[model samples]
Target: MNAVWFVRSRQINRSISWWLAITGYKTSDRSFSNRIYFVYLVIFFAIWGLTVLALVTSTVAEGLQAFDPARPVWLAAQITVVVFLAWWLWSLFEASRRSPIKFTEEDAALICATPAPRPAVAFAWLVSAWFTTGLLFWALAITLGFARAEIAVGGNPTWADAPFYLSAAGQLLLPVILLHLGMLAVVWAFGCLRLNGYHSQGSLNRYPLALGFIFTAGLVFGGFEGIFFQSMAWPASAPVLSGSGLANYLPGNLAGLAWAGLGMGALYLASRRLNLSRAAQETSLSGRLQAASILGDQKLAASIHLKQRLKSGSRPFPLPGRPGALALSWKQILQSVRAFGAGALYNWSIVFALSLAVLLAPNWGVRGVAALFWIAQLHARLTQSLRLDLDQWPLFQALPIRSSYKLLAEIAPPGVLAVLVGWAGIAIASLLAPGINLWGAALLLPLVIFDLACGAAWDVFRQARAELLLAGMAPSPSFLSLVLSGLILILFLLPFIFFNAGLEAVLVALLWGGGACYLLFSLASRSMRKLGK
Candidate 1:
């Protein structure tokens, strides 16, 4: 067997398996208890996924069997699926350009000096892409296929046909796999084009602006319009990917399967034309990012990644005020944009575009929960700014500014933007289905933001305290950061668990929001006292 065969058949599969095993829980080096917990968690999730697949599979199969499919809902589902698939593919393409096919330092040391290294390296790329892209499609198919599942179920209270979704999901799995192979082929071709200087990599980063704008506008506008307008043509015909309407073609036929196979094979051959040294350097970039993540320096990893995407424009924003930490906030906000340009914009657009998903959800409760979850994740990203600032704690203390002003400045812009972004999701949801629940979303989100801002400040403060408190002790598990964030989230959400949306609920939320703000303020001030702020 060739060296590539050995790596692919034995070495790489073991590495991939070991990666999956550890990544779902913790690193391989983590304690036995962590690994055990991770295993239980995986098993539980696996069972839950299978249960869901089972429950819906039969319904899906039945839906597919009908020669004449259901109309508007199905079309909407199809559109959402197509749009999201496009979005995911676009994301993968941008990411690949930023970090094209390459070998790691370890892989290069061990593998690159060998005979015919390019084929092995290319095969490894194809292999990793197979797992990642295949997994992505599996997730999207289940999710998008179930987007309108309730409507499909149609109040049928019977278990007789409830067990077929798994079988159907399994059947669709091949087409899904093929679909991602097609995507990888496209992205890989683009990477090759960039590598050969046929196209600038930065062009891949910039050209997404128009697409992002359309996606954002569609999610915000079409999202509401879809609910109001219902269908362009009610009882619209079912889309066929092969006989296309909105690109829902699945490789259910031999011809389609053959085409998909050929596309992937052709891309692999194309990638084989890549310059090994250049590809090796690109792969090293990926390795550095992965290592940074593994070492718990995600922010640094993100920064390194942005450097590769490499946006232009070093010009500063006009002074927001007389310019104290406002200057810092403005700079950070701009740097996040200018450093990664299209990559950053594309991500933010995706965040807003999720209003489409929110609109598609069956109920306001689902919308509220999803919005809050999105908001919190974005909030956590924003919170990293505080952590970044605290990295130079002595600089902050040495500044001429008062402690309270400094603290407020740190929280203001990003915190407000986080709140605004969260509400955009709600606004779309509300437009689709106007209801009292909007009150809950509108009220609840700001309170959560307030709580998060406080928590982030407190995280910085606690770190400072920890330095003074337990300077000699090693830090706790990585999960503890998540635990801290979750605790803060639960604190804010606690008031929400009992109260239904009403005049009383709104009144209570207002009072709670007010009291929470006051409390957070007091805490922030007290915490600031540590640095004599």
Candidate 2:
């Protein structure tokens, strides 16, 4: 028994070490050039700047909520927490469906074959991977949570209060952790059921699967929201963690925390009843997300989804709305649609949610800066199609088509798609915050979309320049190139911010975005063609 425990611990430890090494730091032993070191220095400073920026944002959020101190702060927190769970549930559904867990594929057959209980070993692996990967994220969260908590207390926390803030954050995490654990265990159990052909299986069985997903997502949403209801009693019980105090008002208070732990434990124990045939299947959203982050460009990440078209032999369908550039635009739009999934138009919904948050948020200037940060992210997603064309630049160049035509076609699809989705987001956001001028919101959406598309296309140019600078001169797609590309994006987006109502802002954005689009795509096109020469 002791030996089994030792082996399990060892496996968990090794996995943790390997994941941390890969994700947290550079892994290659190869010598770096001076330019590489310069990139590292820039990243180091950028991380520090971001940390300070987050703390400042949190503090400002606290001040803004002070306007209506009674309900708004807690409401914002509830929304923040609920939105996250919604996204988590969505990702969980997609992840399990796309890549069903197969234990043998992960080389975990030895653990299953051992005397140690298969379920026990599996749970250990799950908890270890979850903890190791999530630790950094949680650490970051602690800072923001602390800032928010200080607001709850109607006080500003100082450096000396760090320990207290961290303790509060830890206490806050307990029930939430249990809630997440239960969610995960239930999902895993469902996976096991699928392994046995219980639900969401077989052809034409998708309706049942879809229903189950919606139902499950709703349950999680309701559960998390319920857990945070205690926040209703805040300020009254805002301090004490011992009993019937502020701790109880937090999302995962002690009683709820205990129940969640027990529920999750029961779920894991229940998994022991399953038949583990030499192996079981597993794939995770964490892996794909981490890969996308490491790749540092959405195009590289988006490529993974492009190869997933169901009818490989069939050609793309035309977009009747875009007759002039339909042939050029249709494939990109279809690919974005397919890759992003049905019922949702690209990631505009997420941007909308963020925009809503920005609108509700109090600090205009800081929030503008934060919006730029969010725009930087949206720009990454927008650029995926642009990068797709850039990747096959040699092929595009080899054709007899003029460079101007190639550039126009490449940028049009992504921009058109962005406008449609961005408008969807704007419409939804308008519904959420009725204070918004519908006319102004409608007018601003296209400029916002255009800005996002142009920024992304610009990244393709930045990357092309980097590769050209380092090509034959150094390695393929060097780290410095990604760093340089990101720096350029940061510089470009610094001036663009949200306007709840304005034609001036919109016009300015259109001019800047259009000019940047033309200039960068043309430069990138010319640079990419040079690669073939």
Candidate 3:
């Protein structure tokens, strides 16, 4: 008993240590510690608070004395809980099977040399697995059971009530069961493939089998439950069927649940068997590899060869230019812009998705949706530009061209892409909402161009600030700088958005902003030239 206690304590300590490591906690005396702790605490509290709020909202909705049958919030909550349970179960099973036992050479040596029992260590690991994985869900189920009981006693049922409740529960449980079956099949197939030595060879013969199992399981169980409930073959007069009329189909639901459980059990057993086989295979391979290395085998040596590659891949075709200062500056700007575009795909995809949705959606929805997409695109462009300015200052200095030109070049591609994409989105909106004049196109095109120019100038100023910070010449931008910049951009774009109000106002604003930006950029270019030298 004492030995068991020690093992349990050790396992608990190890679990805590592992969690800390994964979460990036380290013992350090840094000023940033407070900031890190504050962020962590905020996130933790926010998650817990949200979860509690959801639970309360769900409970209140369920406990209402007079309920609207059409309102589906309670049903949604029940479905959500069941889905959560299914996901929880799937994650737990996956974690338990995949978490490798940390058996070291030292451990093996100790096992051979010491009188200490290995069973204690094994027992502790088994217990840790339970707590780390499924135990949380088990506790959640208990809490949910209590919540359900309270709601059951608190509410008086209408004819639709019992059927609705049962349907809600069934809807939730069916998805969970189906999800579990699908995940179980996937894990089972992967285990089988690993056991069969197909994984190492990269063969995908088992993929179809795995996918088939998943689809078949999910569809069959989900479909059966849907049909059974729809048919309403069960007696409505039955006591269990009194409220929701769902208890009539309880037997079929149970059968489906049982089948899902059986699938999960089969997956678990398959996984265990496969895991044992893999351990044996790995042990055998380790022995063979050790033997080969000891024997000074040429093939083993060849297999272990390492090579160093240059950090940068082959360069693109160069323009016909002297290796002078201007040429070098152009190269740096090009490189930075190229890098920016590489990471812009995700943002661009979002823009495209929103634009397409707006085009396909109703005319009434088009304006609001297009505006949101426009805002999103603008944010992405600005953020990308800002990040580039922050990172590439040294490269900018090393370039042969003037710093201002380099900054302009960096902003040009995205600015152009943004305008084009924005126009395309507007065109889409126009198609959906007939009688909307495309005259805004002329105003918007120039506005986007002017905005881009202004944004580039602002980014250059921010970069200049960053450069100063690096050289200890100036302080970094305060929180106020960020707020002011955001406000300025919004203020600048406000007139452009309201171009339909008056073209003269739009044109005046564009000219004022654009002229100011160009002038600043020209001055910045001269400053950059001097700094670069």
Highest lDDT model number: 1
The 10-residue segment with the lowest total lDDT in model 1 = 233-242
lDDT of each: 0.57, 0.51, 0.46
Candidate 2 error regions (>4 Å)? 1-121, 132-167, 197-244, 247-257, 273-293, 309-533
Looking at model 2, residue 278 earns an lDDT score of 23
lDDT of 3 by residue, 144-237 (tens): 3333433554444445554544344444344334433433344443433344323342344344445345534653576323554223322211
Model 1 misplaced regions, further than 4 Å: 1-54, 65-115, 134-273, 281-313, 316-384, 392-400, 414-456, 464-523, 529-533
User: Clashing residue pairs, candidate 1?
Assistant: 56-165, 57-164, 57-165, 57-166, 58-164, 58-165, 102-283, 241-249
**Pairs with backbone N, CA or C atoms under 3 Å apart (clashes), candidate 3:** 162-243, 162-244, 163-243, 163-244, 163-245, 325-400, 328-400, 329-400
| Rank list by lDDT | 1, 2, 3
* lDDT score, candidate 2: 0.51
Better of 2 and 3 by TM-score: 3
Residue 301 shift from truth in candidate 3, angstroms:
35
lDDT of 2 at 503: 66
Q: Choose 2 or 3, whichever is better by lDDT.
A: 2
lDDT for predicted candidate 1 compared with the true structure: 0.57
